[model samples]
Structure formats: structure tokens, C-alpha cells
Target: MPQTSKIFYQLKPLLQYVPSIEPPEKRVPLQDKLFWTLGCLLVFLVASQTGLYGIRIGDKTPDPWYWFRAVLASNRGTLMELGISPVVTSSLVMQLLIGSRLLHVDYSNKEDSALYTSAQKLCAIVITVGEALAYVVSGKMF
Candidate 1:
């Protein structure tokens, strides 16, 4: 019998073609990596402060899931409102699958690992779109 994640197995060909940033040819120094990491965090913080382009003041919408904001790393109406939420959601799902043994991960095999990561990416995109649509339909965001 096929597992629920069997569909991801079928995506091997397309996943292989997914472009990825190559690793640094030379090892990066810790200080340099730390500097870049901090810089990115600063940028993300600034972005989270910036509100959505179309949102207006005094437009309070019902938010039953406000508690999840911290976990999902998002703000109410900022550019980071959906920040990493999709990725986190998909990752959480994958973790559940792995923990339940519903999805077997053969980390020793390069192809299997690649497929797992690629499948997560695909799932994240879908979840992102779905969440965005739900928010819009709920009149939470215009």
C-alpha cells in the first residue's frame, strides 16, 4: 500500500531540477557567517515593523489565532505577517509525519533526503497560498 507521502516520491524528476544555491567553494569563517546572520535578522525585524501596503488604520479584524503569531513568526499587518509561517507549517507537518512513522526518511540516501526537502518546499508553497486566500476571504486583509 502507498503511504500518504507517496505523491512526493513521484516528484523526483521535477525536484531534481529545482535550482539551489551552491555551497561556498571555500569554508566561510564563523565571524563572517555570524555577521551575515545578524544582518539578516536586523533586516527581518525592520520588515516586520513595516505594515502591508494596502492596510489602513483602525481596521481591526477578528484574530482567533493571535497566540500562534509568535510560533509562526508573523505580525498582524506587516510585510512579515506571513513571515516564514508557510515554511513552519509545512515543517511541522513533516515532523508529525516523521514522528508517526507515516513517512520514512532514509537520510543515508542523498536522493531520499533531497526528495523530503523538496516535498516540504512544495507543501509550504501550497500552504502559503491557502493561508493567504483564507485571510483575504475572512476580510482580515484587503
Candidate 2:
């Protein structure tokens, strides 16, 4: 096990309490899967168009992150402004760590795999909060 894996192992007790969906006991039908996929897509589209409650974008305000927004599939002043950035960032970071041997994970071991996933979730949550704070503090969301 790598050094970072040891650190993650220490967090196992807390990570176990993180909410997760259990695997389905039976195979899901194709129609049901399609329905859920479309439902989630609809929700995402709606969220992308939903403006933040207290934010108002002025027409003349310059967007410093305009190019970044396009790349991240984010909409300005909307609920989906962050898009999938946090999740993607966390995944990339985890991959980098593992590739560098900073973290060790055994894919064949259920416990190690679960811990790895839980760590990624925790990382994503932290990144999301940090990014939100940065945006607010930089006066970009005002």
C-alpha cells in the first residue's frame, strides 16, 4: 500500500458513513434504464437554465472565464455554472496520485476499491466548496 492509501485507510470509518446507493439486487430492464437516463438528462438541462436565486448578470460585465465556461459546459449565472468540474477534477487528481504511486488501490479488493471511490467523493466535495468560495471571494458571481 502507498502512503496516501494509508491515509485513506485511516478515513475508512468516516467514509463508510457517506451516503451511497446500493447495487441493485436484480438486473435492471433496458426500458427502466433508458427512462432513468432520460430523466436525469432532463433534470440536468433544466438545471443548466435555472439561474442562481440571488445572482444577476449585467450585460456589460466582462466574463474572464468565458472560454473556460464553454469548455466545462457551464452556463453563466446558472445552477450548472460549476457543471462537472469538481467531479472531473477529483478524478484527474486521483488518477495522478495513483499513477505517481502516491496512492495505492487494489481493484480486485472490494474494500480497497470502495475506499478509493469514497476518497474521490470526499475530494470532489472539498473541491466544490473551495471553487464556490473562490468564485464568491473573487467577485465573479456577484
Candidate 3:
């Protein structure tokens, strides 16, 4: 079977649970489905191309020399210029910390409007500083 049909078959159980008047398979027209799929793929390809261009050449179209120079001059960029390994490690560390509740804040029994606002500010500050330092230390800030 085709990959798409296999996926539809896999979702058969969930589709059966829905109390719809028409069956799910026949609900959408073949033309509409094909158009939607192709439209999404075309958009994705365009977006990916633009993003890749931006990364490789930055904003300037003439040359990528300036981008490399800028990366070397900045500390954060220097880390990224080195490699992608540090960035991934730092992201993993932060994810683990948040998941383990090491960065959890208590808002229980505190409904004051001003207090909530202050808490939000505090959380933003912590997250910003934490992420920045994480990148710097892990050698991937750029």
C-alpha cells in the first residue's frame, strides 16, 4: 500500500470513534485533497529555500564574507562558528532542567494582580539570562 493510505488505515480506529454523518474517507474531494497536499509542500519548499539562503549569506546578496567576519567578531557567533554540537547540548541541558522542575515557580494561593505581573517579569528575566548564559558557557550563543 502507499504510505498515505497506510497512515489512513492506521488512523481508522480514531476515525471510527467520531460520530459524524458521512464517513471520513469520502468527506473530502480528491481534487481538494491533492491541492491541499501540494500547496502545503510548495509552501514548505519555498520557506526552506529562503531560510537556507538567509543562513548561508545573511542579508547581503553579494558575498558571505561579511557574515563570517561578523560571526568571528562576536563571542556568541564565535561559538556557533565552531560547530552545532554546543548548541544542541545547551538546549538539552535547559530542557532537562525545566522538565525536572529545577526552574519551577510557585504561584499557588497568590492571586494578587501586581504579584502576578511581577512573577511574569521575574520569569522572563530568569529565562533570558539562563538561555544566554547557557549558550555562552556551552559555546553556542551565536
Best by lDDT: 2
lDDT by residue (30-121, candidate 2, tens digit) is: 99999999999999899988888787744557888889988888888888889889999999999999998888899988889988899899
CA shift at 38, candidate 1, in angstroms? 2.4
- Provide the TM-score for each candidate, comma-separated: 0.77, 0.89, 0.25
TM-score of 2: 0.89
Model 3 clash pairs? none
Rank the candidate models, highest lDDT first. Answer: 2, 1, 3
Give the true-structure RMSD of model 1: 3.2
lDDT of 3 by residue, 87-128 (tens): 344456544644775543233533232232333344444555
On the 0 to 100 scale, the lDDT of residue 57 in model 1 is: 27
How do the candidates rank by TM-score, highest first? Answer: 2, 1, 3
Per-candidate local distance difference test:
0.80, 0.87, 0.43
Residue runs of model 2 more than 4 Å from their true location after superposition: 1-4, 57-60
What is the lDDT for 103 in model 2? 84
